[model samples]
Each structure stands twice: as structure tokens, then as C-alpha cells.
Target chain A: MSIKLTYFDLRGRAEVIRYLLKYGGIEFQDVRITIVPWGNLKSTVPFGQLPIYEEHGKVSNQTIAITRYLAKKIKLAGNNNWEDLELDALVDTTSDLLEKVVNFYHERDTERREQLKRMVLAETIPFYLSRFEAIAEKNFGFLAFGRLTWADFFFTTTIDMLDAMTGMNVLKNYPHLQGVVSNVTDLAVIKEWREKDKSSVVLANDAK
Target chain B: MSIKLTYFDLRGRAEVIRYLLKYGGIEFQDVRITIVPWGNLKSTVPFGQLPIYEEHGKVSNQTIAITRYLAKKIKLAGNNNWEDLELDALVDTTSDLLEKVVNFYHERDTERREQLKRMVLAETIPFYLSRFEAIAEKNFGFLAFGRLTWADFFFTTTIDMLDAMTGMNVLKNYPHLQGVVSNVTDLAVIKEWREKDKSSVVLANDAK
Candidate 1:
């Protein structure tokens, strides 16, 4: 394929790219590696990381960077520079949330992990989701601006992973945040994409 | 001040914004909060974080996002959307390196911290730096494009904090990366900005 995105099987990092491609109706190869020993792929890719986007064999790493490029190409980018900045900031805010969720899950010690779970569910999640809910309300259910942008696509794509990590519906208390998620999922194209033979290794919770 | 950037006194995250403003010949307020208990200021900002950019009374956060907005305003952005993707990817790569250094530095257990330091010096830093060096060489001393894009500005600004965290000359072996650093720092405006009445709490090694 001339256009490709290669990543791991689950929705750890590459889901945003996949969601956007579906949302934008772009035809490209979505190559998810389910194997453990990513031997040659690890050494061949830049920074030895996945979620690499290739256009006509030219590759670029960095998940958000790839998504922003796709967003701009699909006309999902902001209307102006300021709007883009707001979107970028909002996307990074979700990234911050993702980082906390990652740390909470990756802690190996049982006691520390439980402690982290409490802190994340009680404080960190609320800190971010509350502010995001307010922003969504202000933006008319959109995350950044009072219109559809790539940030919505990015956030909804990430929420599934957050839901799995937090072991609860992290969006339970935030109605507007739920709207942000539905706004993207309710689109006919996205609904159709999820219905198709997405892949053999689609994350268990991603179906909804 | 009509335009402002507020962050901690150290040249940690906000240095890119300052350097970009200087390079772009934009004049604005540079507010460095040196004291502890940044109680009121902390509560007032979005995300309760520093390194926020403000124009008049409006504010925005996220270091890369703020710098990107300024990059567009100052013409430091790429010639096209693809180029912006490249720049953004490069900047985020530096951010990844910064994350490693941050995790290394923040490990409180002495034995673990030393282990991390060794791993970082031996493996992690080399893995990223070698790739960055090749990229800089290919791009003619710039990180992304063979032009003075914001990625160069972002990397050079971030090198100071990396230098402090690693506690050694991390770029000593990478001539191209060093050139990338000098390409931004050697600019007359940047040189002058460093020489003027710099902030009181400037990090000890930053004077060089």
C-alpha cells in the first residue's frame, strides 16, 4: 500500500490514526503487529517505535504528529491558527490523561498500584475530566471549538483505553465529555468502520 | 503586558517560547516566577500549570502548542502542512528524550536512579541522539527540514534542561546535534537575549 500505518495490535497508541482514517474516508493500510518479537520492525523504524505513518514509503513517527497531518489532509484541522492551537492544546491535555492512566496500570507492586489507582480515580481523573467537561459544555459538545475538529476524533479514540485502564466508565460523571465521544462515534462512517472486520486483535472494549 | 509567558525561573519548558519570540523579533513580557508557593498564580492559570502564553488577558497552555502558535505567527513554521508534520514530529521526539531524562532524574531510590542513569547514558540517550544526529546531518544542521524551522528552536531550547538532567555533556559525541544547538543559540538575537539582564533564578549552567 502507498499509505500505511503500522502499530501494535491493541489500541494503545495508534487508535487515533485509525479512527481519523475512517472518519476522513481515507483508504490506507492499517497494519497491526500482534506478535511479541518485533525484531526487525523495532530496529528498522525511527526511534524504534510503532504508530509510524508511511506515505508512499516515506515514514514519520510520533502519533500526534501523524494524526495532525491526517487531520489537516482530511480538512479536520482548525479553521485558523488560533483554533488549531486550541485543538493542539486540548489534544495534549488528553495525552496528559493518557500518561497518568499508563503509569497507574504499569505499576508492578500491588500496594503501590492500588494506591495509584485511588489517586488517579479520585484526583487526577476528576481534575482533567471536570475541566474537559466544562470546555465541552462551552464548546457546544466539542472539545476545543464550537465546531468539529480533530481533537474530538483524538479524544474519543483515546477514551476507550482510558475506560479499560480506570476499570470504570471514567466518563460517568462528565456528560459533556460523553457528548464529545458520541459526536464522533455517531457519525455514519465511524459507526460503519467499527462494524466491519476491523481486525483480529481489536481491543475487547473498543467494540462499543 | 499585552503579550506574556509565565513559567518557573529555570529554562526548562518555556525556553522555546522565549527563544522564538526573540528570534521572531517580537516584544513582550517574560514573567518568571521564582518563589515557592506560587499560590495565586498557580490557581489562576489553565491546567494550573506554568509556561502559559497570554495575549492581553487571554491565555493558552501546553508548551509545544504555545510554541507552535507562536511559530506560525513568527513565520517559523514549515512551508507546507507536510513540513509542519515533520517539524512537529521532530519536536515531539525531543520531548520523548526529555521524558526519559525526566524519569531518570525523578527516580528517588538511589540504586534505581543510578541504574537508570547508567541505562540512559549507555542506551536510551544514544538510541535517540544517534537518530537525531543523522537527521540533523541530513537536514543540514536542522532537525526536520533543511531550513530554520521551529524544531531547531525547540531542540536547542530543550538541550539546556537535558544537559542539567543528564549531568554531563549529552551532545558531546554528536557533532551534528551540537551544530543544531549552535545554529539556534549562535543567532545574534538569542546570544543577546542570553547576555542581557537575564532572570534572577536562571539555572547555574545556563549562562554558557
Candidate 2:
């Protein structure tokens, strides 16, 4: 099936799907649009949003939905129904953290942005990271089960994005999260893709 | 398995899960905590969030995650992997609408609240509802596939909540969405539950 992912040039929402497709050895056209043209392009898409996945000419939006679809196809989803539920919960939790960090990134007001940054760095990040750290510790470094699931991929990508946005190694204090990052990035396909993908490479360098 | 759902007395986030469990003939303890005592109960829960579903002593949070778990157990999810993806995408879209409406409901500033309410009523509601109405029309009155799935249940309960919050019959202009509500409420199990559940009855009355 011909697949094409359309989103902005940044790794904002489509990064995890890109990583999952690469890790699963799937090939697709990565169409990155810039901000200037997004206005013209917005009305044509479903939900008028980005990171849309078009498979066999059928388009679908929503980042989590697209990611879950690809994850299930790649066997990155859990083994059974219950396991999938667990993985879904973790992915949603990671999304909660992502929203907070993204809000901090996009805030225009200097005072409010500082307040958001402080909340994220002090309360939000630690609150979520500590829970995730405990979960990873229990599951042998994977986020959901004892094996790699889509939640790990989602967490890994979000952590990279968070670090890039905040210019802080947010995972440095959380060893379990660090392990998750290493576990996901250590995949051969992801490493290869990161090396070649300009957006991922730039994000990696920015985080460092 | 013994099931217990803990949330505030209101149907803010847990209502969809409640509706799904009821529709599935799954009996659960509806544990409602008011705001006054929530401060004391906050730190004990995972992520310190509401609508935590406890099953046989295991606890899980994230409303969509919990609802999806129960929906699968009751055979309310889609028939196949692709269908599940469609359902997930629809659920996420409904969640997007829920966020906007809830923002308007909770806004304290009168001028800001008025602006948010206008946006929700004018742009957000129509944007999402028109898409959903078209989908329902194509699916023979159901949301995702041509059968009753969890997305339908989620959409039904959320529409009810939106109506209650906005004090408007949100489904009035969208006949397809109204058809969806009728299709779900026509289920014998849901009808029986609504008749007996005071919270559901109150919401229905408020919407009326």
C-alpha cells in the first residue's frame, strides 16, 4: 500500500509515527510542509489538522490515532486486548506531558511562558516522569510490558522533543527514562533514520 | 472481576466509561468523590487524576484508555484492526471537542468565557459536528463502521455532556448526530441504566 505522511517540517507530532514506521521497516513518502503554506493547506485536510496519514489514498488525522494504527501494523502494540489497553494508557499519559511542554514552547507572553516553564520543569515533568520511571523499573525498562511497545516509542520521541524545546536534558535525572530512550534509539532502523533524517538529527543536536 | 470507577460526582470525564460499562452489562461500583474531600484523596491515585478504573484490585487511569479496555472486554470495539484505528481516530476527535467545551464551562473570566463560548458554539462545534454528521450519515447512523462501536457510545455520552454544559441542544441542527444519540439510547441496556442511574437521568433532564 502506498503511504504518505503530511505534516510540518518539524518533528512536532509526526516524529513518533515516523520512528514507528522506520522501526517496523515500512516505507512511505514523508511530505513536510512549512508554516507559510499551512494556511492554504489547512482547509483541505480532515479536521483541518496536520500529521495526517494517507494509506492507499484514504486520509486519517489525529496523532495518537495515526500512531496507534501504525503501531498495531508493526506489532509494536501489545500482544492481547488487555495489553493494548495498558499501552494505550501509557501513550495517553505521555501525551499529557507532551501537551504541557508544547504549551510552554508556544507561549508568547514572557511572564506566562516563564510560569509555564517553571511548572513544567518543577511540577509537571517530575510528576509524570517519576510515575513513568517507576513503571519502567517494573517492566524491565519498557514502558508498558516487559517488552517494547508503542508507548516506549511514543515516550522516547516525546522526551527528545521535550528536551529540544526546553533545552534541558529532562531525562538526565530519571534513569529509567534514560534507559527507555537508549532502548528505543538503539534500534538499528531508528539509528539509521535519525542519521539521515534532518529533523530528527537537528532535534538530537538541539537536545544535546 | 470486581470493577469500581472512582471520579467526582459529576460526569465530566467518567461518563462515557460509565455509559459503556452499562451498555456492556458490566456492573461497576460508581464511586463519586466531591471536591471538598478530593484534596485529601488526590495524592493516593495514579497521576492524581479522576475516573480511575479499578478491576480486581488493579487500577488504571486515562478516561479513553479505561473506556477502550472495557469496550474490548464487552465486544464493543471494532471488528478488526483497521476498524479499531478508525474508532480510535473518532474517539480522539470527540475528545478534541470535549476539551473545547470543558474550557468554556470552566472559564472564570466573564469576557474570556464569553469569547470561548462563542468560539465553541460557532467554529469548534460546527467544525467537528459536521464531520461527525457526515460520517454517521455514511455509516447508516453509526459513527465508525456500519455497526455500533465504542466510538458511538463515547460520542453519545459526550454529546449529552456538551448539551448539559452549553445549555443548548447541540444535536439539534445535526440530525445525523441526533440519530446517533437515538441509536445508542435505544439500546435496552443503556435505557435501563439511564432509568435507574440518577446522574444519567439528571444529565438527560438538563439537556432537555
Which candidate wins on DockQ? 1
Q: In model 2 chain A, where is the ten-residue run with the lowest total lDDT?
A: A199-208
Q: Which candidate is the best by TM-score?
A: 1
Q: Which residue pairs does candidate 1 place in steric collision?
A: none
Poorest 10 consecutive residues of model 1 chain A by lDDT? A199-208
Candidate 1 lDDT for residue B191: 92
DockQ of each: 0.78, 0.71
Candidate 1 per-residue lDDT over residues A1-208, each given as its tens digit: 5889898776668878988888778889988776556676698888998889999878899999999999999988988888888889989989988888777787766887899899999899899888889899999999876788899988987787788777689898899999999999899988887787355333443342
Output the lDDT of residue B9, model 2: 74
Error of 1 at A202 (Å): 8.8
lDDT of 1 by residue, B35-124 (tens): 565676776677787788888687899999999999999999989877888889988989988888788777767897899899988998
Backbone clash pairs for candidate 2 read: none
Supply candidate 1's per-residue lDDT for A78: 86
